[model samples]
Target: MAFLESVFAVIGDLTWGWALIPILVVLGIFITALTGFAQFRFFRRMFRVLWPGNQSGDPNAISAREALLVSVGGRVGGGNIAGVAVAITLGGPGAVFWMWAIALVGMATSLVECSLAQLFKRREPDGMFRGGPARSIIHGLGADYMWLAMLYAVCLIAAFAIGFNAFQGNTVAGAAQDSLGIDRIWTGAVLTVVAGFIVFGGIHRIAKAADIVVPVMAVAYLAMTVVVILLNITAVPEVLSSIVLNAFGLEEAVGGGMGAALAQGLRRGLFSNEAGLGSAPNVAATADVRHPISQGITQSLSVFIDTILICSCTAFVILLGGVYVPGAEAIDGVVLTQQSLAWHLGDWTQYFLTFILLLFAFSSIIYNYYLGENALSVLTESSVARNALRVIVMGIVFLGAVAPDATSVFFFSDPLMGVLALVNLIAIMMLLPTCLRILRDFRQQLAAGVARPVLNPEDFPDFDLDRTAWTGIDPDRR
Candidate 1:
């Protein structure tokens, strides 16, 4: 076990620690500049188009707005809560600033990838439309990119469905044990059963479950965070100063220094919101919208909600509560946040947090399940294949829950996720021109007083899109 852990740790360091972070940050900055800062330009529009009523009337179709919530169901989970804690624990307060940086930068990266996903989306029998980085590669870049597309799908399944799902399972079972004194094995059993029911129910059921789950969990967790923030209002300046100072290695807060903080922030920030990792695009492409940019804008908002709001809230709660000591001994993500909240509010709050984290983790699992399904569909449309993978996912959750070492789980998952980011980022870079054109086209239509912009498939004679989804569109049937 130690040998395996060391091997994965070496792989993770090579991936997230050295290679991927600079590339991800630079790519996000380049995309952000390239789009003329679309995240800010469409910020207001994101809210305007997000009303629940904007959802589709067709039972088979997920609307742009609903897609945001469903994607949020995936985005906001253990990553936001435990991930932030882990960041602060390992990276220090300065890490929070870096997480913020990643979120701000990633918003634009998300816009490009998700819009590309919607643009190159293929119609699916199970859902209104299906698309992702793999779709973007296969359709946007031509047949020569087929090998890369297949690689993307395979990386997504291993990284997200298998690697990420295990982390979520580990978090849920661990939290349950800490808060409720539930045995980890028993917790794993109940969680796998519940998750199985939702996983087998397909996309619509997953979408509906996400709609109900995302908002409730966000409110519950944020409300708790606000209470702590209010209690420690006077400490805000000191906390903020510490974050900035530690971030630059001006002060010693934890771990190594600026380098440690930056790495954790980038890695966990990606884990929390998944800006450029190509995960959200899988679900984003499922939305049936008149314009691909509509879903793109909505998904960028998911990045903001996940990292900027939820992740920051978690960071502040720990930093302000006085429970997190500078240079503390090995910090456990689940325990640190739980203990900090309890320190601020009371012991009873621990149960509340555990419940909230469970919701976040469970919702994330279903979201991960769909990403897996989409990845498999991009490879093959076999029912037996999809079903077999679903069972494998359930079994992974069970094993992850009962697993003795949480650190080993993270060590194993980080490199896989890094591979995902590397592949997806490259694909989006190839399709950037198409994304920029779509953005410009949407802005022109908006400026010309079109209330809701519609995309014409023929607008770009260069690339072939699903003509059935664009013009001559059936709001329902493919």
Candidate 2:
């Protein structure tokens, strides 16, 4: 077991080495500059697009609210809570600063890639939406790179099936075991049954489940954190100071100095929102929108809400509860989060968080299965193979739930995911120009009051916006 873990560790380091961060950072900055910071510039318009019933009647896409919810289903996951705890445990309070910095940059990165995913998105024979680097790479880089695209899809399947889904399942079962002594097998079986129902129902059902669950779970988690922080409100100022000072190694207490803290935070932040990892793009691509940029902007907001809001909320609760011990061995996984919340809220809080994690873990199970199916679609033209892959993926949900501990589950997930990120980041860098050009054209039309929809790929040539003027206002326009 130890030898296998060591092998995975080496592979993880090789895949996620320090070299990629700067490259991703540079690409993030480049995209942000290329779009004239489109993420920030169009914030108001994006918010308007998100209003209920706005863009509701568009036949081409899901309601913007539903789009946002589905995206949220992907964004807010084990990472926001467990991922944050691991960051602070590994990097100290200083890591929190890095997390913020990553999110700021990540928002732009998500915008670019998701928009590109939108640009090349394909409608299935079944009338569902699917896009991402798989589509973008094939569309933008040409069919010659189909192998490279397939490679990306393979990596995605491996990562989600064994690594991510397992990690989420283990987190749920571990929490349940700790809180209620529920046998992991029973927990796994129950989760498998629940997940199979949602997984087999396909995207609209998954979107509906997410729309109902993500909001309620998110609000519940947030309210719990707020209560923990409010009880320790006096500690808030000190917690803020510690996070800032340690983030830069200005505090003598944190002891790791600046570099260590920053790495922990950046990695965990990336993990939490998965901005550059390309997983969220799979979810964003399913949004039933007429324009790729709409999903792109909606997804960018999700990055903020996921890392900046939900992940931050978790960090505050852990820190303010005084559960973060700088010298203790790295927290490694979700247990530290459970411990902190338990410490602050007592035994019953453990059960609540376990249930919350169950919701998070189950949603991710269905989501990861969907991502696997799309990745499978890229590889095989065979319906039988695709269906087999789905069955295999569903079977893994039980494997994930019954996993022994957090560290083992993480060991399984991190390396495959690291490779997935590396492949995805490469594709994203290649797709940046198309992303920039589309943004430029879209902005020009918006300014001219002639924002017509780019409904089809063939329309790309005739997508001249300077010719048409807005007639009656679209409600989403407000």
Whole-model Cα lDDT of every candidate shown, in order = 0.85, 0.75
Per residue, candidate 2 scores C-alpha lDDT tens digits across 281-320 of: 8877776565567678878888888887889889998887
Kindly state the number of residue pairs that clash in model 1: 0
Q: Any residue pairs clashing in model 1, and if so which?
A: none
Q: lDDT per residue, candidate 1, 1-478, as tens digits? A: 7998888778788877788878888999999898999999889888865676666667667777668888998999877877888889889899999999999999999888999999988886554688899989888888998998888788788877888888888888888887799999998898899999989988877887887888899888889899899989999999999999988999977768998898888888877888888899999998888888888888989999999898989999999986788787857787788889889988998899889978988998999999999999989999999999999999988888988574355566667677777889888888898888988998887887777788877778787798877873333422
Q: How many clashes in each candidate?
A: 0, 4
User: Which portions of model 2 miss their true places by more than 4 Å?
Assistant: 1-10, 58-61, 329-333, 403-412, 450-459, 462-478
Superposed Cα RMSD, model 2: 3.8
How close is every model to the real structure, measured as TM-score?
0.93, 0.90
The CA lDDT at 471 in model 1 is: 74
Error of 2 at 314 (Å): 0.8
Estimate the overall C-alpha local distance difference test score of candidate 2.
Answer: 0.75
